[model samples]
Target: MKTAISIPDDLFVTAENTAKKLGIPRSQLFAKALEEFIQNHSKEKITEKLNEVYSNDTTKKDNSLSDVSVAILRNSLKNESW
Candidate 1:
């Protein structure tokens, strides 16, 4: 596919230099960059959807242990030399 797009001169120069240094054509460099950008954003979209689904659960649960258990655990930890 052949297409044209405009970018800042500095970016264009940098891409050109990178392509030369990597021994690839400018089109290949642009295509690779676009492909990588799309793949990354696709993963981000999945994460966003997972976050949206999980965000709807507003329920909170008490996960803390009883005071006696906490005191025993703390005493055991204190006896161990760090």
Candidate 2:
């Protein structure tokens, strides 16, 4: 895919220098950087969205745990051979 992006002059200079140091083309460097940036920030964006939704919920809710289920969980925790 071919696309156009405008980066600041200083950042472009740094990117070009880094690309030369890594022995790769500027386009490859930008693509790799974009891939990493998306991978890192997408997870962060998902977490932020989840936090926003959960924090905005004002209702105190009941969890559906039965007494037998709680006892089984406690027994499992007490037993070393889980």
Tell me the whole-model lDDT of each prediction, alpha carbons only.
Answer: 0.90, 0.88
Best by TM-score: 1
Q: Superpose all Cα atoms of candidate 1 onto the true structure and report the RMSD in Å to 1 decimal.
A: 8.6
9-81, model 2: which lDDT tens digit per residue? 9999999999999999999999999999999999999999999988874543423346567888888889576
TM-score of 2: 0.60
Inter-residue clash pairs, candidate 1: none
- The residue-by-residue lDDT of candidate 1 on 2-79, one tens digit each, is 999999999999999999999999999999999999999999999999999888744432223465678889998997
TM-score versus the correct structure, for each prediction = 0.67, 0.60
Displacement of residue 34 (Cα, Å) in model 1 is 0.4
lDDT of 1 at 73: 90
| Backbone N/Cα/C clashes per model | 0, 0
